[model samples]
Target: MMVDEHENHTIDTVISLLDILIIIQIEDDPIIGIVLVALLKTVTKDRLIRILLILLVITLGEVSEIKS
Candidate 1:
């Protein structure tokens, strides 16, 4: 069970890295990040994807709030 949790945490970290890349590219107005995130969304499902989505949403909300 601990091993499984560790694996999930590693996967979440990878997803968060991807999301960070997306956020960076979005900030720079780059096209590739948009394409990459779209492709990832199409390929992933359930737990990992949902976690990434929630992280993305929260990060975006925080950035927007900061900007405002």
Candidate 2:
């Protein structure tokens, strides 16, 4: 599926922010961090606010998977 520009931007923004957080909290591979962030946005439809909240949840998740 294709995402619109707005959605793409939202995903990009969320992933960037998540990348920063992961850098601070974890010392894992950056590629894994990015993939995790992308997975979070995938389930959130690229909504900016939802992405923000998902960041929090994913950061706190034991498994790094997004939930509704």
TM-score of each: 0.42, 0.39
Candidate 1 lDDT by residue in tens digits, 11-63:
87777676666656465465766666666667777666656674676577568
Supply the TM-score for candidate 1. 0.42
User: Cα lDDT for residue 42, model 1?
Assistant: 74
TM-score of 2: 0.39
Model 1 misplaced stretches (Cα beyond 4 Å): 28-68
Report lDDT per candidate: 0.68, 0.63
Residue pairs clashing, model 1: none
Candidate with maximal TM-score: 1
Collision count for each candidate, in order: 0, 0
